[model samples]
Target: FSPIQRVNYKIEETRVGRLTNYDKLILEVWTDGTMTPKEATVSAAKTLVSYFNQIVSPKKVEKKEVKEEADVIGPMGKLSVEEIGLPTRVANALVKAGYETVEELAKAKKEDLVKVRNLGEKSIKIITVALVEKGVKFGE
Candidate 1:
């Protein structure tokens, strides 16, 4: 059977020709360098054919996903926020301050962070620095 996706391969040595399915003949195949139209030698071609047979398998259907009424976009929806390794304290602080997104945090000012419960000058400075390092601006 023909490959559904043409495998990109380079021949590293010389090869030969052989008969394939549908009684069609495969000829001089390049073994040492790259893919070529020329048929390979009989033995080399047989070896390549065998290798190809062993490596390639018929495609199979993976587990089916149940259709849903809603659609999610991008990698963000696939993984939970916890999977992204945000610190619990930081997340809690953000949630308490009503800042649930990176954009919101980036746009926050020093005074805004100070207004949040349990937050102080040191925490604000640290958060500001971290946000700036991530290319987010607070006072800009």
Candidate 2:
């Protein structure tokens, strides 16, 4: 979500309480009940900004947690795909196909690895070079 200069309306309120951008300033607006849309938004924004400046609390940011699925990745999150040094498309396909680590890819049989949709002989050769660079050889 993009940050606004000022925020005044409730973005969403669920059972977990009001969910909003951590950086936004949420405030209640009380107009004469006959204000136009533009006037209301402008006035409410001003009040929100004013209140935010007067607040003493520090802003909080939410951090996202990355979780690897066990059954899917199958004991293979040790090495990053970037370390494989394969061409972009092939390396990305390998990662997407659940080979998370170079060691895991090295353990696979050539015949089996050839079955992957986007990977081909040229990509396989590239992968071999990458694995050899890391002191690993496929089908060892």
Candidate 3:
């Protein structure tokens, strides 16, 4: 299977309810001839008002401008993981253990991988070689 040529995704609230949180997400994938396929996944929605109705303390939603400007730079979220060509599980383990970005992966030592579960000898060797090819070295 090939990777997606282009895609966009967003998360939204689905339903207004109490004591439950639901999420709705929209994903759009692009194909040839300028064609775009869109899909929406919905989850059960919950609102702070519903919590207040049930006499539970409701959390506040602070107002903030979240819109992206026309000239936003750099990738977001899991895109970095894809660019590095590492397994998702490995990338997540690295990130969770305080590895922020690809540059950090180069300088990661053996002990770092040891700290992550399931990153035994074989996995460490594979990752190390891959990083070396990318000119990433431990303590570099």
Give the winner by lDDT: 2
Alpha carbon lDDT of residue 28, candidate 3? 69
**Candidate 1 overall Cα lDDT vs. reference?**
0.54
Tens digits of per-residue lDDT, candidate 3, 1-140, equal 32336768799877766734788878766645433342211111245446666676556779988654211222322234336677777777676777656555554668767877766777677677665555555433
RMSD of each predicted structure: 13.9, 17.1, 22.9
lDDT tens readout by residue for model 1, 25-118: 3333334433233333444468888888866964476987964311322223243322334567766776777776655565566777788887
lDDT score for candidate 3 against the true structure? 0.57
* Best-to-worst TM-score order: 2, 3, 1
Candidate 3 TM-score over all chains jointly: 0.37
Worst 10 residues of 3 by lDDT: 36-45
Better of 1 and 3 by lDDT: 3
List TM-scores for all candidates, in order: 0.37, 0.43, 0.37
For model 3, what is the alpha-carbon lDDT of residue 100?
58
lDDT digits (tens) for residues 5-69 of candidate 2: 34355544334347443453455554554664457768657999888876866467688666534
